[model samples]
Target: MLSQFKTPLLLLSSLALCACSAVTQLSSTQSDATITIKEGKHSGNPRSETLKTTSFGNYEFKVEQPQGKVLYGVLPLKFNGGYLAADILFFAPAAFFNLREVYPYYEFDTEKGVVRYKNKPQDSWLEYAPLAAESERAKAYFNAKP
Candidate 1:
């Protein structure tokens, strides 16, 4: 009776919690841009990747330039609406934390000859700079291009 329903209810709750996250992929046109993770997995620029996760977390990746410059940065994959709703509705205590921004940003500085993650230009050129309009514009621009 009650005991029999407990296991199923827990399983369902776990599934509901983990299903909050959504997948998104990003890419760049620079041929030299490559990504390498700590696990030694190598990927050719972020092109058509299917990123899926259950928790809001950040992963460190190094972007390599053709000129041999290694740019270390964090690519932030924010929590989708479902994740937020799930946290607020069921995990109210965890909702106290801001899980939206899970990583730092990176920007390239030409004059200093370095890629910076702390200082940013007033006019940033990063493809995904966290602006809704800009992100959509970049997506449209890239999709429109050959």
Candidate 2:
């Protein structure tokens, strides 16, 4: 009886893996990247808000203070060839969902006094450039009042 269900379960698991679009940029051997407050009163502390990566290669984070002020940012991600190759070889359809695998690096801009996210891909700096805090969602979050 147990064996009767085993094959179906295995098939389902494989299908789910094949459907998984966003392969985490952090490799199985590495730890998940963390986001911390770069400056301000909370500087150097781990941010309590949640950070999530989209299937299209974007990092989104939001922090809301007790006073109702919201601070948020979205960092664009760059494609990783190594992961792309692995995904193609293992999960073909999932490989086409997204090519981006990591967020390279991020820094606190002393001049701008804001955190800047970056990625240095070969030849093209467009995907590697820093992202600004002008996104509509971020704007709304900041403008929202309690």
**Top TM-score prediction, candidate number:** 1
lDDT of each: 0.45, 0.41
The alpha-carbon root-mean-square deviation between model 1 and the true structure, to one decimal in Å, is 12.2
TM-score, predicted candidate 1 vs. hidden true structure? 0.43
Q: Write the per-residue lDDT of candidate 2 for residues 87-132, one digit (tens) a residue.
A: 6765666565556533444443222324444444343323222345
Give candidate 2 regions above 4 Å deviation: 1-54, 62-71, 96-98, 109-114, 117-134, 141-146
For model 1, residues 1-146, the per-residue Cα lDDT tens digits are 69998997898688565553333333334455665432223465553333334253444445566786544444544555555676687665554443443213344332233333321235354343333443344345434545
Give the Å error, residue 68, model 2.
9.4
The best candidate by lDDT is 1
Candidate RMSDs in order:
12.2, 9.4
Q: Ten consecutive residues with minimal summed lDDT in candidate 2?
A: 24-33
Q: Count the backbone clashes (under 3 Å) in each candidate.
A: 0, 1
